[model samples]
Each structure stands twice: as C-alpha cells, then as structure tokens.
Target: MKILFLDQSGKPGGAELCLIDIAKPYRDRALVGLFADGPFKTLLQQNQISVEVLTTQSIQVKKSSSFLQGLKSLRQIIPLIIKVVKRAKGYDLIYANTQKALVIGAIASFFARRPLVYHLHDILSKEHFSQTNRRIAINLANYFASLVIANSQASQTAFVQAGGRANITTVVYNGFEPKIYQTCESDVRQLQQELGLIGKFVIGHFSRLAPWKGQHILIDALAKCPQQVTVILVGDALFGEQDYVQQLHRQVTALGLKNRVNFLGFRADVPQLMAACDLVAHTSTFAEPFGRVIVEAMLCGTPVVATKAGGAMELIEPGINGFLVQPGDFQELAQVITTCLHERHKTATMAHNARKIASQHFDVKIINQQISQLLSSKFN
Candidate 1:
C-alpha cells in the first residue's frame, strides 16, 4: 500500500529515527514529506528512502503556544496544507510522525479522502506541553485520526487522560535492528583506547543535550560517584537549547568534573559508542514518551539506568534487565552507578538479559510488520 508519511523535524530526534524504520518497508511505495530541510533530509537520502522538504518557512508554534499563536501560524502553513492535500490523494494513508505534522496531515487527510494515522511520540502532560497545545492535539486526533500509534503505554495513558479517544489509540514501542548494535570487540577496544577510557568505568548518556533530558542531573550524579567513573555525553542540543548545553558545561566545571566528563557532541556511530561504555543512562526530568537510548543501549548488550517515570517504567525490570532511578534523584542515580561498577558479574548478566529482551521485542522488522498489519486492517 502507498503511504505518505509526514514529519516536522529538520534534525533527527527519537520520533524521526523511529519513522526511518517504519517507512523502510514501504520505501518503494511511500514518500516522507518533511516540513523543513536539514540533516534529516540528508540522512533519509543516504538510506535511499524517498523524501522531500515541503516548506521553507518555519512554523512559529511552540509546545507552549497559545491558541492565537497557533492560529497565526496557520496562514504560513496553508500552502503546505494545499501541497500535502494534493499529494496525499495518491496514497492510501497519511501518517503523521510529529505534532506539527499531525495538524497538517489531519487537514490534508480530510481533503484528500485518505485515512490518517497519528504517531503519538510525546507525552501530552502539563510538564511537557501547555494545556492549550495538549487540547488542540488530542481534539484533532480524536476527531480526524483513524488510528493513533502511541510509542508506549505511558503516552497512550496521557492521551486518554487528556480526553483523547481511547479506542483509536494503541501502544507500539520504537523498534531497532539488534544486528546494528552488535559491535566488534576489537572496535570497542580501539574506541576505548582512542577516547582515553582505558581503565575507567564509562557511563554514557545518549540523548540530545536539553534541560528536560536531565544531562545536568547526570552531571550532579557524577559528582557523587567515584573519580574512576567517567561520563561521555553523546549528543548535541537539537532545538534552541544551547543555553542548557552552556549550563551543563558550567555545572561540570563547578563540580571540578572537567577531567571526568567528555562532551562528544553528536556522532553517527551511536551503537559502537554505546557498546564501548560500561553503562548507559537515561535521565529525563520529565516523562519520556519512549526512551530510545535505553533500548539502543540494551540492544548493544550494555547495562542501562533510566529515570523511573513514563515509558522508562515500561521498558525496564529493576535489577533484572536494567535499573530505574527516581527522576532528579542524583543520590539514587549515583548509588546505582556504583552498584553497576562494583558488581561486574551481575551487571554483565543484566546486560545479557537486556540484549535478549530487546532483540525479541524491539527488532525493527517485527515492529514494521505490526505497523503494516495495523494499516492493512484499518484500511480494509
């Protein structure tokens, strides 16, 4: 079946990365219509996937945008709506991958007479979005979307709590290719030597450097850990969160962790980097819709310690596959890190369990099949 997938990001976020896997099966018969042009479009091209940048103007709406602000941005997106409406007629479905995409795709689906699928990637909580934005999103999906594919049960629950139609929503975790994470031992050793991580216990944080991502929390936790436990932050600020990045740097310096922390901003070889680390951390201050880094680390046979909230609670089984710590609790986070560092045999066992579970549940091929089946069932 032909599909037209819509996304608003110019850079690759968790949702955009998830879209890559979901769209691959339909590559020959599908098109990904992006709202802006940047590295994301380039990455899609590298994957040989059909993609196009549908707009040059940025949508002037934020997660905290008021109703008037949202309405004002509507004028700018009219041409984009027309374009998508026209193009969507050739496809069987319009799949919206981001919140802004949902707004446009819902309208396009109405005009194009195609079914709309809204991929709910964020938790519509007051902590993450303003009440106005949450209402707009929930109301639109409830009225227009034929199906809502939530990234986790937590996301789906948040939608329902915010008055979304429960019947239309279903949980579908982000998928990964376990094979991609199977890094060679020689490569891991070489990277360790190259990064000057020869004998240190490396703790890796793999999300974009944002305040809500809690990179500072990790830094705080690092201050309480042993000097031998070092951290390597593996991503750059994607949005206008440069201030948070600067704040993190200041915090690192203030704590005298300048030598213990390595800021390896945005690298493409995430799996290899994750494999080189002794442990991976997910320290989001707010509820994560889904912790992609947590699963990515698991797939790499690496132990993980994530914040105990939102989708993270769904992914980990404490002391089994991985460990979960309370959000913002640096004391607990530090304790867990120490535990992983001290108990090498037990941590290795947990890492093995994490890899096995990740391979079974989150393999991209399995998830794509489920998504394909869902689309077919809905269309029929």
Candidate 2:
C-alpha cells in the first residue's frame, strides 16, 4: 500500500527515529515529506526511503515561551500543507509522525479522503505544552484525525485527559533501531578511548539536554555512586537551554564530579557508545513518553537502570532485563548502580536477557507489520 509519512523535524531525535518505523512498510511505494531537511533526510535516503523537503524555513522555538513561536511555525508550514494535499491524493493513508505533522497531514488527509493516523510522540499534558497548545491538540484530534497512535501509555492517557477520543487511540511503543546495535564484539574500544571509560564503570544518560529529560538528576545520582563510576552524558542542548547546561557544570564542579562526569554532546555513533558503557541510565523525573536509549542499550546487550515511572516500567522488568529505580530517588539509583557494577555475572545475564527481549518486541519488523495491518484494515 502507498503511504505518505510526514515528520516536521530535520534532526534525528526520538520522534524522527520512530518515523523510520512508520515509513518502513512503504520504502518502495511511499514518499516521506519533511518540513526542513537536514541529516534525517540523508538517513531516510540511505535506507532507500523517498523523502521530500517542503519548507527550507526553520524556526528555533525555545521552551520559555513557545506560543508565539508555534504560531510562526504554523504560518510558515502553510505552503507545506498545500504541497502535501496536492501530493497526498495517490497515497492510501496519511501517517503523521509528530504533532505539527498531524496538524498538517490531518488537513491533507481530509483534502485527499485518505485515513489519517496521528502518531502522537509528544504527550499533550501541560508539562510539555502550554494549556492553549493542549486545547488546540485536543480540538484537532477530535475534528480531523481518524486515529491516534501513541508512543507510550502516558501519552495516550494524557491525550484522553485532554479530551481526545480514547477508543481511537492505540499505544505503540517507540521502537529501537536495533540493526545499528546488534553486533558481536564491536570495536567499542574506540569509544572507551575517546570518552575515557577504560578503568572506570560508565553510566550513560543519552538524550537531548532538555529540562524535562532530567540530565541534572542523573548528575545528582552520580554523586552517590562509587568514585570509580563515571557518568557519560550524550546529546546537545535543545531549544537553547544553555543556562541549565551551565548550571549542571557548576553542580558537577561543586560535587567534585568534574573529573568523574564527561559530556559527550551529540554523538552520531550512539550504538558504539552504548556498547562501551557498563550500564545505561534513564533518569527523566517526568514521565519519558518512551526511553529510546533504554531499548537501544538493551539491543546492544547492556543492562539498564531506569525510573519506574512512564514507559520505562512498560519496557523494563526490574531484576529481569534491567533494574527500575523510583523516579528521582538517588539512593535507590545509587544502590542499583552499585549492584550492577559489583555483580558482573548477574549484570551480564540481564544484558543477555535484555537483548533477547528487545529483539522480540522492539524490532522495526514488528512496527512495519502493525502499520501495514492498520492501514489495510482502514483502507479495505
């Protein structure tokens, strides 16, 4: 079946990564539309997925006051909507990969009489978006979209709380790009040398440095872990939260963790980084819709320690595939890290189990199959 997938991002974040699965079923028959083209376009092209860049315009919206910026983004995306609606006639379905994409593609679906599936990656809760934005999302979902595919239960619950139709929403976890991580003894030593993980145990927190993502909390936990343990923070600051990044540096210095913690900002080779790590960490104080890092870590045969809140609980089974600590409980977090570091054999076993579980559940094939079925049922 022919599909037109739309993602508004130019960067390869969790949303764009998840879009890879959304477009997997239609690599040969589908065309992915992007708002602003960048590395993500190259990634889709590399995978033999057809991609089109509609708008070269990019607006950097800081989280401080995004309402004004949101209006600007919507205004700039008008031409994109027109182009998509004109092109969407041939597609069997419109799979919108993000909130803005949903707003655009939902209209396109209406124009083309194709079923619209809004892939809800971001939670509609007040924590992530403003009250005005949340209301708009609810209204749009209620009026335009045929179905909603939430990446996490928390996201689905948030949508329902925002008055979205519950029966129309399906919770599909954001999958890992496991092919990048599945390897037998990759040369992770390069990461070890680059990040200085030779003699120390590394606890990795790999996500964009956003306020809700909680990189500072991971640093707070690192202060309690053994001195031999190091924290490797991966990813760059998003929406210009440079003040938070500066504060973190001060906190690390105050805690005498300057030497113990390393900021490897935005590495493209994440699988190698995960493989070199002793353990992966998910420390988002707020509910992380889904921790792609947790699954990527698991896919690389590495044990993970994540908070029990949100989608982490859904993916991780405490004491089985990985350990789950209470959200923001540094004592519990410290204890789990200590346990994993001390018991090499047990951690190794959990890592093995993690790989087995991730391969079964989070593979791209499973996602492609589900999307194909969803589109088939709707179109048939």
Candidate with maximal TM-score: 1
- lDDT of candidate 2? 0.83
Candidate 2 lDDT over 247-296, as tens digits, reads: 88999999999999899898878888888889998888778788888999
TM-score per candidate, chains pooled: 0.98, 0.92
Best by lDDT: 1
Residue-level error in angstroms, candidate 1, position 124: 0.7
Q: Which tens-of-lDDT digit does each residue in 238-282 have in candidate 1?
A: 768999899999999999999999999999889989999999999
Models, CA RMSD each: 0.9, 2.2
* Steric clash count of candidate 2: 0
Superposed by TM-score, candidate 2 places the C-alpha of residue 232 at a distance from the truth, in angstroms, of: 1.1
Error of 2 at 62 (Å): 7.1
Q: Rate the local accuracy (lDDT) of all candidates.
A: 0.94, 0.83
